[model samples]
Target: MAEADAFIFAALQQSGMLEASFQGSSWSVSALTSDAFIAIVFQFLTQLQTSDDNVTFTLPSTLTNTPVGVAARHRVGSKLANILKELGYAGDCGYNHFLYPSEKETRNILSCFLSPQAAEAEDDKFAIIQPQSFLANTLPDVPLSLESVSPGIAGGDVTSGDIIMESVGSSGVATKNVAGEENFMQTQLSEETEEQALEQVQKQVDDTEHRIAAMRKVLDRERGELQQVEQHVLETQTTGQEMQKQLARQKQLITMLPQAQANIAKLESIFQKNAEKKAEIAQQMESARDPLLKEYAQLESQKSNRKARCRQLIREMKTFRSDMLELTGVIHSKMESVRALERIHERQLAKLDKKKDCQDEGPMTRNMYTARIMDIIKQVHKQKQDITKILDDIKGLQKQMNVASEKLKRTEAVAEDKLYTAASKSKTSNSGKSEAYVECYRKFAQVRELFEELIVLVGDVGKKENIARDLQNWISQLEARDSSSHLDKVLADLESVRHENGTLQNELRACSA
Candidate 1:
């Protein structure tokens, strides 16, 4: 663990992420707070985005050159996470870790930038950090031809030692400077991230298992081919021995020597062809076996990755399970409180029954009552205002959640497209047809998601269809029932209206006269 810490600390220093004042012994994951972590990531990723065209980031609107609020900080963190994901960062890059960094998660994240090789390299020894760590040993093979004029100053054991010692010095600086309380940083993944990570790890395990199986299959095929070749060679040897015996028996004949010579020549030609076929088989075996071996090696490396991930997940699960146990304890305590409150309520009821109070338990003056009433009214108004403000905040948060969810979805889609799909040009210009192929991986993923959504929607649709049919049938029955009664009532009302109109007109005429 110390070695790992040393490695991580050394890397941070080498990459200039950690300052010169930061010492290796003092360096720990606690120093990276939510804001601090986001700032560092933003700085690194912004620089990365500038250098690489492929690396794009979706900046939070509220984020200025300096981010202020927690939400803005989180958005910035998520942006960094998206960028890291797009860049194919291996371990957990979720914003939760940025908000609450763990030693393992922080180290994994730092390694992404300082030692990209850490992911693909078969061993830590093969990482770039290892080379720099052993600069004293490796510098001897270096030629000072570029600085031939000042070879003495340009390259030597002293310079190499300094180069090695510099890392040591940076790590030392980190030790003295990196002081922070360990309690502040939650040294595990958060609750939401845990499920995502478990799924991701399961997928990786399945992939590695599948790859290892395929490699084994290729090796088996190679072994079978090799066995067949050996059997064929054995048969050839037996046939040649028989032919030799036949030629030896016919040696008395004058034509036998020529015949033997002819047989020998034919045998030589056969051997030559056999040799060529053997060479071809060997080449084929070499080609096939090498890739399988490489794949096996890669899988072996991934085995370590999967192990580390599994351990991390186990740790996260353990922490969460403990929290769950604590929650149960809290729930039991609350139940006890509820029972106590019930007893207290019963005692209060008994007291109320025993103690009879006088009617005038209030202030003597009406002015006092008025003042009290006004105070109550003011307090009610204040409470109402507070409620409204709280509701407004809730609405704002809901909007933010919706917007962030949509943004993350769109960003992931674009990131996937950028990371995986390369635009291919047709080989019709003299190259090749570029393999007749159809890749609908992304499309299929979308369709799968659509079908899953449709599954839920179809049930709702069926229910709605039944409801509509019932409503339509009910409405049709209503329309078929009461029309004649309604028409008779309407005719009676029209007759009454005509009589009233005639009376009103005659009254008007008499008034005019």
Candidate 2:
């Protein structure tokens, strides 16, 4: 029974709610209290984030017969100080304040404290006071009853003490009073320590100032080098832009070169046709000459015969002259075609010149200028889309118009054949029949007029298509030239600038070092 009772008591002790004490109380002076204090301090230090805050201390009579014990108070102050330190305050007094209130209070009880001099230098300056609540002194303990106490402002029934707040103050060194040789020695030692610290700080400040001056000199040198590099880049950019302009001009010429060759071919074709017409005219002239010469021989044989032959030859000669005149007109038309082609070539050259002038205005690599060019490219692209849509719409309309015109042409052709057959038949019939034929012819005229109108409209549409095609071709050629030459030049210029920038960076680093 004795062994069983001992085991039961050990089990109760292990359960931890009950404890073995030296006397009447059940509470044991185990490591748990110290552990609890450490845990509290750890939690407060880890979790606290405040400049000013209140800490509540509960005097738990159940946890101890000695509620206001020195160890307990010390633990409480240490926890509070740890919490304040974690909150970035400068309270230096540790757990000493709780054990000796007067000494701790005079020495500054805060682990995190701030002074007025420090406050003025800060941007968000404000003061705060943390109040400590002693709950056991404010509340009554019931007779022979053990109640667990926890501290807070809310529970007035258990609170036993008034919350005390302290004033804000600064912490610094206190002057020592010298009387004996020991005191004098202590004072001299303290002064020597402070002087040494001040001298070390001064030395650090001087070294820092020297380093700053050296860095400044280096930066100035780098700045000068950068300026020189910038000038070089500017020159490179200018040269690149000039090259780009030439390239653009060449590109424009490239686009028009084929068209120029086509124009020459067209002129040659016209000239060939004219030559064939001239050759045929010459052959006819030669043939006419032979006939006239034969007539001349006949005139010699007989005078009357010669007169008749001569008159016939003269009439044929006149007809030949008329044919020559027609040939001359055809030759003139061919010459005009050649002139038109030459004019077109001249206009293309002029456009190339204009492009060159525009491209040569300045260095294309300027950041602002390149940005503007990009903006222009965007605008051009947008315009191209709009133009393409317009062209598509025009093409759609032209297709419909062509269909309508072809239908009108077929209808007009059928009407004309019917009118021609009816006219011939009406010519052999009576007056009434002739009048009917006239009415039919009038309707045919109206149909012909409608067909003519449709043709005119279709012709107008064709002209518009021609104009649009020409404009689109020009824009495409210009944009292609701009992109290949201008954009490439800009990119080259950018690369040069980037190289210069790298050089400048190296110089800056060297200067810094």
Candidate 3:
């Protein structure tokens, strides 16, 4: 029975499926059971098969005939089917009593346990199985122990001591197999974990490099901006220096402003003094003009009075000339009467001579003739006395008219000379005064012309002795012209008569003195 047990254990270990199931649990002796172990081994192998193939396991004939062995096999097969289903294998139990729908392989399972070293040497043969696909089923193959193999089964001589030594050796080999399998699993897990850690470190390195590059670009951009700011600061410094120079120039101008203002004040003072001087001169001129104006008015009044006196004297002279003409006519008639009286006296004398020749006649006739002659002589003497008185009265009136005309002429000449001198003085003094002064000068010139005309006419009157006859001729000429044309002639004749009367009066005054 021990031999049988040894054979079964060796057979289970030799199968690739059983080795993987044992390695999955790290070869823990407590988890291993006869039925569960058989199920895991069969399920693993069945999953390795292709869909169109079938996997077969032939049991010992003695075990298959027993009820307990048959029941155990059935239960193990059911468990195997359940494991195969969990591993994603598709198949059903067949009438030939083997798992169906599996892949085909020619390798013997017993060789994996018999020569574990040989299996390692052929590791390339199963290298296609990925760690993630069969990790739960994978395990290291362990060499079978010599003690676990009965000599009778192997056909070799054996003894009690050999058995004891072999047993010890077998136990040590199993311990070594469990430790080797654990070490192999740890090596795979460590390799996978190292690869993942390397990948994470590489990813971190890439991210850090990218971040550094971005920071460098930002630094370059900020450096460029800082350079521009520095240039602006340099330009501002230059502008500030120029502004300081301008401020100095402006300060110099500010220093001169007070002197300029003082000069302006001095000029303003001079202008004000000049204006005051102009006002003073105007006032003095106005004061000097007042007396000249008064004198001019007085002279004008005197000229008007002189003109009126001259007109009145002309009228008186015209009346005196008419009276002188009437006196001359009466004197001529008186002279004719005196001549007729003398002729009558001569006739009477002749008659008296004839009467003396008859003297011898009577004495009474002689006395009557003497008395008549005496009466006629007395009447003739009275007539002569009356004629002499009339002649003396005519001579006295002519002398008085001549004296009045001479006085009037002399006064007119003095008034005219005074007016001419006044006009000349006003023309010189008031030349720039006003328009009225110019008008006064023109009036003075007209008066001068009238004075000249009167002087000529009065000189002619003085040369004429028959003043009445000359006046009569002038009147006759005036009457011959029209009234309108004779107005100027009449005025001229009146002015001549006035001048003649003025000359006569002046002469009379000279003689009387």
Top-lDDT candidate index: 1
- After the best TM-score superposition of candidate 3, give how far the Cα of residue 44 lies from its true spot, in angstroms: 99
RMSD of each: 42.0, 43.2, 68.2
Across residues 1-513, which tens digit of lDDT does each residue of candidate 2 receive? 344333333433442323334123232222224334333334333323232256433222233332366667665666565655554555554665443444234223211222322344353432232222222334234211224444343366533322211111111112222246668899999999999999999999999999999999999999999999999999999999999999999998788777997867877999999999999999999989998999998866675564355445434434543553454355445444544654575477558646754776654445645676676677568656855765675566556545654554555555556556656767777546777767867865875576458547755765775687579668757865765545665676677678767998999999999
lDDT of 1 at 308: 58
The 0-to-1 C-alpha lDDT of every candidate, in the order given, reads 0.62, 0.55, 0.57
Q: Residue by residue across 1-513, what tens digits does model 3's lDDT show?
A: 344334435545554445454544244323445444444444445434532255343223333222245565665556544644454444443211222212121012222223443455479667877754453354222123444766685575665446545776899999999999999999999999999999999999999999999999999999999999999999999999999999999997787688998867977999999999999999999999999999999998987787566556545544544554455455445544544554454456545534543452332232344454565566557556755665576567557656655764565555556545555666677765435545654664575466558657745654563475568557756764656743664466556666666998999999999
Backbone clashes (count) for model 1: 10
Candidate 2 displacement at residue 390 in angstroms: 0.2
Ranking by TM-score: 1, 3, 2
RMSD of 1: 42.0
> How many residue-pair clashes does candidate 2 contain?
16
After superposition, the stretches of candidate 1 with alpha carbons farther than 4 Å from their true spots are 19-24, 50-66, 117-483, 487-513
Q: How does residue 120 of candidate 1 score in lDDT?
A: 39
